[model samples]
Target: MKIYIVGSVGSGKTTLARKVSAKLQVPHFETDNFVWTRHLKGDIRNEIEVRDQLLQDAIILDHWVIEGVHKDWTDPGLQVADQIIFLDFPSQKRVQRIVKRYIYQLLRIEKANYKPTFSMFLRMFKWNKYFEEQMKPEFIMKCNVYDHKLYRFQTDKEVKDWFHQIQRG
Candidate 1:
């Protein structure tokens, strides 16, 4: 089973994905790792090719969870996804997470493939705007349009509960 988790920046999509993947003992493919050249360089990596390869490899396997923001750009990755999870935390929570994330990045504490930049906060705000103004409705529409099972969570606790449910199943 392949699961896809999507949400605005700082929405805990990656955190939830990691939990789900760990619970299921499934590999988690983070698009950020494939899309960025360095931790924060934002250089153009083969977004399409790498994403496609990851999807192809996972499809041939039995289980995995893929998560990221570039849902439209990674349409192929979502094709075989059995579940789609979206984090809909409040703006304040999102802001807090983003700020914490940036602080960690600035301190070189968050060692993910992406780096934190000064503009990351602005980007976070813009991302929130885009999601609120555009991506949310579009995502709901596409979720229904595609007829895939979609799960929405408002808090980290809910996400944790869902992970337990997945584990129990």
Candidate 2:
């Protein structure tokens, strides 16, 4: 039951992955953990060796979930996944979520690999631009090419119901 969850920034990919993974009692892999450098301001590590090792390990496991918005790092995981979950919410909703989450993280002193800096929000505000320029045409194209069984969810309740259905079935 390998699952690969892909979504836009602040669409709750990590939250959903963690919940679903726990429900299914499977290992959960966050793409940030795969590509992030230990140092705070270092470059993202997308080396073949690092990602390859993670993919190899995940393949050997019977059940695992990988979640992220990274296309290059996620491509290898997608190859081995039995299910794909795409969270495509409204741009406005996504922006609200991002802003709220960013505020909460800042208040709590929680660190996110891709922190919500002012510059990031400025770029993210152009919702159509993000989908058009980054995620939709490129990352989604690859997913379509592979013919992955993708589950698209719009609302939080729908996502929960889908997980329950998966659990019961």
Candidate 3:
């Protein structure tokens, strides 16, 4: 089963992807990894050709789970996904989660792909807002034709319920 999970910061995209990957026994990919070359100092954007190729390579796999906030260049993933899970929690909830996650990362209780600096924390809020105000509509429009394969959830329970009965769907 191929799954593409999309959500803004603090919407639990990585957590959900990890869970699904383990349950389905498929390799999991993160769009961030494709977009950036992480370093101790910071992340640098991968070249467009390199980034697109990495994403294409992952989606071509027979079974995989990919997660990210990137929609502009990830239509390929959407097209191949047998299931597209959108974590559509409200903006307020997302902001709260972002704050809590920052706290955990700050305390070293949770590991992040990038350093959890205050600047990055602030950017998360901005990214979350951009997602709601700008990207959400476009994303929904793109997924409209995939209604048969799309699952949108506003709460944690709703996502859990869908996952438990995923095969049945």
Candidate 4:
């Protein structure tokens, strides 16, 4: 089960990937890990060839679940994915999650890959807005060719029910 989950930040891609990966016993990965070299201070972007190669290696595997906000560089994963989940939640809902997650990270309730700063917090909202205005429409256009394998959900219940159905049948 090669599943690729995509959405804007705070759309719950990581949570859904964890759940699906656990239920299916498939390895899970984050495109962020490929896109940026994680560091204690700040993440550095990986070279394009390095990022592409890493993604290629992962998608070529037997069973995996990968999630991210990445688009252009991830077309190969989209092409190979047995299933693609897009959590196209409304902007307000996503913004709320971003706030909640940032708070959690600030209080050390939740771990973050990078330092949780006010600047970073502000950037998340900015990214979300950019995603709403640009990324979503671009993704919709790019993913139309993969409609047969794509499963888009706007609500948690709908996603859960659809996932359960897939697990059963």
Candidate topping lDDT: 4
Q: Following a full C-alpha superposition, what root-mean-square deviation does model 1 have from the true structure?
A: 2.5
lDDT assessment of candidate 2: 0.77
User: TM-score of every model?
Assistant: 0.84, 0.81, 0.95, 0.95
lDDT per model, in order? 0.77, 0.77, 0.92, 0.92
The whole-model C-alpha lDDT of candidate 4 against the native structure comes to 0.92
Per-residue CA lDDT of model 3 for 50-165, tens digit only, reads 99999999999999999998977999999989989999999999999999999999999988999988999999988998999999998999888999999999999999888888
- Give the range of the ten consecutive residues with the poorest summed lDDT in model 1: 34-43
Residue 12 in candidate 1 has what lDDT?
85
Residues 72-149, candidate 2, lDDT per residue (tens digit)?
Answer: 755767777888898887777888887887787777765666665777666656743577467776766777766648
Q: Which stretches of candidate 2 lie over 4 Å from their true place?
A: 40-46, 109-128, 145-148
Superposed on all Cα atoms, the candidates' RMSDs to the truth, in angstroms, are: 2.5, 2.8, 1.4, 1.1
On a 0 to 100 scale, what is the lDDT of residue 123 in model 4? 98
Give me the runs in candidate 3 sitting further than 4 Å from their true place: 167-169
Look at candidate 1 and tell me the lDDT of residue 33: 64
Over the stretch 1-169, how does candidate 4's per-residue lDDT look in tens digits? 7999999999999988988888888899999999999987779999999999999999989999999998898999999999899999999999999999999998999888888899999999999999999999999999999999989999989899977986885
Quote the positional error of residue 131 for candidate 4 in Å.
0.6
